[model samples]
Target: MITLNHYLFVSGALFALGLAGVVVRRNIIIIFMCLEMMLSAANLALVGFSRFRVTDGLPDYAAQSLVFFTITVAAAEVAVGLAVIVALYRTRQSVEVDTITRMRG
Candidate 1:
């Protein structure tokens, strides 16, 4: 049968993948995506723990609330990050990290 440990392991794997992406990628947009992926991994573990803990007939609204807040903030982050990328692209003519470093207002 599935267990909380199983979910935790899966989440850990996903988080590790995201971390690798963030560390290895030079592109800013890809790093942002990796950050989002890491957040999703945390959410999975939170929900899994909440579900297991609430088996005693208690409410698990906390986990749901946390996930909701995470998603809201992630959406905001993506919107702002994309805007920055767009602005950088316009100023530099390319979205690459090397070109972006030379960007000026």
Candidate 2:
């Protein structure tokens, strides 16, 4: 049977992979995707803990509500982030992080 530990392990693995991607990849878009992956990992862990923890018969929705808020914020982040990426690409013609350092002007 799947348990909280299993969910936590999966979340941890996903977070680690996302971290690695963000650190190793040169493309801004991939880094943004990895950031989203990390967020998803956190959300999974939150939901798992909320589902497994005993609440003395009360309906525990705090974590779930937080997850919803997180999702909303992530959505907005993606919209704005992608727009910025597109603009950067239009100006630089490349998505590599190193190429953006000259944008000091």
Choose the strongest candidate by TM-score.
2
Per-candidate clash tally? 0, 0
Instruction: Quantify how close model 2 is to the true structure by its C-alpha RMSD in Å.
Output: 1.4
lDDT tens readout by residue for model 2, 1-105: 977899999999999999999999999999999999999999999999888866897546998999999999999999999999998988889999988887552
Q: Give per-residue CA lDDT, model 1, range 1-105, as digits (tens).
A: 988899999999999999999998988889889999999999999888878877469758789799999999999989999999898877777766765554347
TM-score of each: 0.88, 0.91
Q: Tell me how far candidate 1 lies from the true structure as C-alpha RMSD in angstroms.
A: 1.8
Model 1 misplacement above 4 A = 55-59, 102-104
TM-score of candidate 1 on Cα atoms, chains taken together: 0.88
What residue runs in model 2 are displaced by over 4 Å at the alpha carbon? 56-59
Q: List the residue pairs that clash in candidate 1.
A: none
